[model samples]
Target: MSIIPSIFGGRRSSIFDPFSLDIWDPFREFPIPSSSDLSNETSALVNARVDWKETPEAHIFKADLPGIKKEELKVEVEDGNVLQIFGERNVEKEDKNDKWHRVERSSGRFTRRFRLPENAKMEEVKAAMENGVLTITVPKTEAKKTDVKSVEIKSLESYIQVLIDVLTAETRQNRVTPLVSVYEESCYRKISSEFL
Candidate 1:
């Protein structure tokens, strides 16, 4: 009697061999997408990214931090110009242990720091955390001006004397003298203002 091949024992061939594919064609024809690109396509409920901007008067920082708690977050100044932010995220199964067949949520620590401009005022800095996001702002210090007062010249004599002194000093110091010399020539002069 001839025995027929058992259906279960029938030989089967794999559609594609992994080893053969690797050896035959090592280079991937299609480019792989990066984490940033993948995250951008997803909704905020799934992933979040950071965004920031700066203005002449202040610097603003904003970050998406959904599903996080105030107790898990911390903000501190590392130095005069460093702003640091750190936080931890923990996701546990709400139901009893066995009911959770899969855990896909991410859990870890997140941190970021910013190096502020020299004019930033640490004392005036402020931060707020709300709706799973954080925003921080630091104001810039006002610009300063020179302290010297203006000198009034009523007569051409006084003006010429002043101009000579200015030109002599400028030329001796290898600084620009054309401005002082022009003023001196336009106004008639007699004696050196310093000696007189």
Candidate 2:
């Protein structure tokens, strides 16, 4: 009924042992498998789902971590821009004979990380878990203007192409061309006729 893994005990032998040939031994010396690897093999592991919301003042994240105890949960802020939530739930069953038809739920460690907004205030962050829902609130910090910027200059080639496109589109409609395009075309035609 113990949840811990069972350990088998046996005598060790060297290759020089005459009576007990270590080479013929059933249990060969090998490195013990790590507990993390064993935990990964276990079929029961927890899965967490998360929901995010953004507001003008703050961004909120609501995560669903079912079957996990509050004591097992860990929450922390990382890298000044990320909030990490992780936890593990251990379920021990004494009845080994009972058969399980379907085991869809996870039962191990679960984690969820969220990126904070640029204006997020790390000091005012808060988290609460209720009914398997973990809600993390990060308040928005006041944004300061980095530097004064100038307006981008439009390329003359693109500007002229845009003007031609508008004029072409207006002419394709078979209706009267717009006064702006007509004036522009007449001006260009007059300049070209004078040059010719």
lDDT of each: 0.67, 0.69
Which regions of candidate 1 are displaced past 4 Å?
Answer: 1-48, 93-96, 146-196
Tens digits of lDDT, candidate 2, 95-127: 879766534344577677777767888778898
- lDDT, candidate 1, 1-196, per-residue tens: 2234337754333346333222233332324434654454343423345676888888888888877787887778878899888877776648555554333345667677788878888778888899977888888887776799887756756666666787878877879667666665555433444334
lDDT of 1 at 103: 39
Q: Tell how far residue 153 is off in model 2, in angstroms.
A: 20
The residue-level lDDT of candidate 2 at 52 comes to 83
Worst 10 residues of 2 by lDDT: 21-30
Estimated TM-score per prediction? Answer: 0.50, 0.46
Clashing residue pairs in candidate 1 (N, C-alpha, C atoms within 3 angstroms): none
User: What lDDT score is found at residue 53 in candidate 1?
Assistant: 82
Count of backbone collisions in candidate 2: 7
